[model samples]
Target: MWLEIGRQHLSLWRNIEIVMVNAMIPWGNHLLLPLGTLREPFSALKRADVVIVHHADMASKLEIQAIESMVHKYNESVPIFFSILAPSHFIRVGNISYTCPLKDISHAILLCVSAIGSADSFVQRIHKMGPMHVDRLDFSDHHSFQPKDIDIIRKRLHKLESDFSAVPMMVVTEKDYFRRPEVLEHLGYEVLVLCSSLQILPLKGCNEESFKKCLRQHLEIYNLA
Candidate 1:
């Protein structure tokens, strides 16, 4: 959350195993971006160890530059990982499931999309996921459950079904799902949650692996002296 790590870093740290970090908005019980967005004047990212430049929003880039610039005063050659999120979902079917790119999903009825954390970034990634129609719903991070909000979402689903042939179920990220109480009570069996991992290196150059390798090698040499 502090540095908004990428998949490459996550993968490397996890030894190439899938590693997914929770990105629910607020990131906690309070504060929409306690550390990820660095909403404070300049309190946090400047202190980050590694910063991920994966969000597609213009603000993410600005934040990356600002954070890097501020941190530079303390350490000029800090490592920054540029990344891209593949619009993929991690399906958990009684713990016997795996990750799949969104386009590959054929049986899913509704593309329930929302992200209290970096919604813009999530939206761009979703565009790449596929052509399944979605009833996108967004809420503030750590946003408390309100019956009214559920009603609103339900109403949208009803409308989505009216337009589509299927009844349209639900699909959301693990991060956002935890915030909703209804998700546990009703969605556990009904909704299909898509899980994803972070990849925080070199999407900008589209050579994330090489970029990470370069950064690691550079860091190794720097530490050698």
Candidate 2:
């Protein structure tokens, strides 16, 4: 429909092809669709010319293979790339802030706060950073935190410390910090904000260069025209 509309309205434009219809499927092992977190049935993959499995590094080999197999079943010809959201650095939330390496938080008890749709993935990524422990308090996606919410987080952090007998550090996603900077700042503890970026997994048949070529070829058409 988009192609037809583009052609109808802008017929003078030349050589426009929908080179690829890419679909992003987060690394998840669950029941298909209705029963679980899947946005669509595995069969829906047939429409995708390329599939990106994000957070691939966090998943076990078996889990990765399972996801790959499911995608191949629906669309064997479609190229599937495994990708990881690797953490780059931690930015302190305050008036005068500094960045730290992910390893700097090693062995520290963490109170992870997030309202992201992929809260489980956030927790997994945080744990992978080698923190001694992570206790997550999840809210609805894009939840604008209120004073009551701050209180809830404080209570959870205290509980985590008392139960584990360790002083816990506060951690939040970049989104959470941007949404309510003042609220997190006023809280009596230092908060660490995590930043991450996509790192394509280099597999046997597919690698970073190959993935870049695929994307470049798709967009090159527009560039040339």
The top-ranked prediction according to TM-score is 2
List model 2 lDDT by residue over 59-135, tens digit each.
66777677677667778887777666678999998952689888988999999999986788789778888988888
Error in Å for residue 188 of model 2: 0.7
**Model 2: ten consecutive residues of lowest lDDT:** 16-25
TM-score of each: 0.57, 0.76
Error of 2 at 211 (Å): 0.9
Error of 1 at 12 (Å): 26
The lDDT for every candidate, in the order shown, is: 0.51, 0.72
lDDT of 2: 0.72
Per-residue lDDT for 19-82 in model 1, tens only? 1222332122424344445333233434444445444233455555564465455445545555
Query: What is residue 186's positional error in candidate 1, in angstroms?
Result: 2.7
Candidate 1 — which pairs collide?
Answer: 6-199, 6-200, 7-198, 7-199, 7-200, 25-141, 90-195
Kindly report which residue stretches of model 2 are placed more than 4 angstroms away from their true locations once superposed: 1-36, 41-43, 161-166, 221-225
